[model samples]
Target: MAASVIELSDVSVVRDGNTILDSLSWQVADDQRWVILGPNGAGKTTLLQVASASIHPSHGSAEVLGSKLGAVDVFELRPRIGFASTAMARRIPRDETVLNSVMTAAYSVTGRWNEEYENLDVRRAQRVLAEWKLSALEDRKFGDLSDGEQKRVQIARAVMTDPELLLLDEPAASLDLGAREELLQLLSGYASAPSAPAIVMVTHHVEEIPAGFTHALLLADGAITAQGPVDEVITAENLGETFGLNLSVTRENGRFAARAA
Candidate 1:
């Protein structure tokens, strides 16, 4: 069997006397692509934070890559997990060039500098940018790019280190129809790559799910509504329970779409 990349057992998170996540258990095996669907404030982001080792669960145990939280070096663990979110984007210097933005991820730096990088590292960064179709934007400042372009650049940066896990928070949130479609295509390509890492993407819209995602977890009221293989867990009944609305979900070409029943 493939090793489990992420395991959470009865995990819960509380903040300021309020419970944000109730006891939850989940396991993600190596090479699985998961989609986390939830309404706002359902703790989807919190779950990703735990998986990325950015936040510890307030109760129970969380294990990532055979290392349990509170028992391992988080700094070392963090470099092996790629994370991209709007919150993270706001922290990066807007004036930094696209290439520098990706290169800084290797060192977890925020901005460009005069320091030198190894020739191989530079080439690797360029290669990722090219793969993401951002080679032309290498010289462009991050602040000057469109929202879609920024998102692609951020994804490239996230993968710059060849992480074992990749977490994407709402990668399609601010995109227009054309941009969203383009991004989905890129994401689909990545999802099908044999060398791609395990992936978890958080999104409210079912349309944002890529073509090759294999599993799903739906959250509501800080609890899991349903979770398992995508074809079984993403039914209308489960989605309706998760979101508190009647929803009819359909799959086409390995992609999902939902509508009111």
Candidate 2:
């Protein structure tokens, strides 16, 4: 069996006396690509935070990349994990160049702040840009790019470090049809590659899940309603339960769509 990338045992997180995650237990293997689906306030983002080591569970055992949370230094552990989210994107300077935005991830900083990078780093960043189809925009300022371009940039930066685990918080959110499909194609390619790291993406819409994702976890009210192989866990029954609405789900050409039943 593949090594476990994340292991959460009876984990619970409480904030302001409200339970965010209630005794949740789950595991993600290094070879798996998982998509988390849930409605608003379902604690999906919070779960990603635990996997990223950005937050420790208020109770229960949480381990990421073989290191136990609260026992290991998060700063060191975080470099081995790639995280891309709107929160992280906001920290990036608007004036920063695309190449610099990605290169600074080598040091885990938001912007290029006098931190020196090696020749190898520059080459690697350039290569990543090319791989993500952003080579033409390398010199462009991050703020000047379209939402699609910026989303791709964020993902490129996340993978720049060659992290062991990649966590994306709604990578396709707010994108137009063209942009969303473009990003999904790139994500599917990456997720299907043998060298790709274990990935977990949180999104509210089933349409955003890229091909090659192997597993699914449906969360509701801070708990797992269903989880396992993507094919089995993403059924209409599961979707309906998670979202509190009767939903019909369909799959075609390795993609999924859901609608009200």
Candidate 3:
């Protein structure tokens, strides 16, 4: 097995007298792509915050890419971790070109200012756009794109810096069926690439679990219900327990689907 890219031990996060994450322990390794599934308020996003070095645990320790969260300089560590979420996308300038949006990630900034970028940076951004099938939309405005297009562009931006770990929150949450499938296919292809970064995506629907994901983590109310291989951890019973309803999980053509029983 590859080295652990993320390790959390007895981690907990408290805010406003409420425990957002409760003594959670999890590990992610290189070459493994994970899907985090749970109901609302399950601390799924909180887990990603810890993994991305955006927050320190209220208790226990977290080591991401070999650097302890509280002991290391997080600003230095954050650049190596790529995170893309709807909140992050909301910060992007509406009129910014897609190319610049992706390129700005190289500088760890959101909006482009008077900063000068070298030709190499431009070419790399172009390549990332092409890799995400957005070469034709490079000149388009970020706000001009559809929800699905915007999601793809955000992912392209997240990975433009070639991060060691990628964290995505609901990358397929709002898309229609065709758009969702298209993004899923693209994600499946990206996950299969040998050089792609380790990925952890948070999604509510099992149907959103892209192919090539190796592991699953089921969370309910900030505690883990199951954690292991996707097949073994995401059983119907586990899903039912996590969601507070009886569920039937079925797989077809290498994808997962869940329904309330």
Best by lDDT: 2
The candidate with the higher lDDT, 1 or 2, is 2
lDDT of 1 by residue, 175-240 (tens): 999989999999999988989999999999888989889999999989999999988988999999
Q: Which lDDT tens digits does candidate 2 get at residues 1-261?
A: 699999999999999999999999999999999999999999999999999999999999999999999999999899999999999999999999999999999998988988888999999999999999999999999999999999999999999999999999999999999999999999999999999999999999999989999999999999999999999999999999999999899999899999998
Instruction: Estimate, for each residue in 33-85, the C-alpha lDDT of model 3 and write its tens digit.
Output: 99999999999999998899888999999999999988999999999998999
Rank order (by lDDT, best first): 2, 3, 1
**What does the lDDT come to for candidate 2?**
0.96
- Tell me the spans in candidate 1 whose CA falls farther than 4 Å from its real position: none
Kindly indicate the candidate among 1 and 3 with the higher lDDT: 3
lDDT of each: 0.93, 0.96, 0.94
Q: What lDDT does candidate 1 reach at residue 170?
A: 96
C-alpha lDDT of residue 164 in model 1:
93
Superposed model 2: Cα runs more than 4 Å off: none
RMSD of each: 0.9, 0.6, 0.7
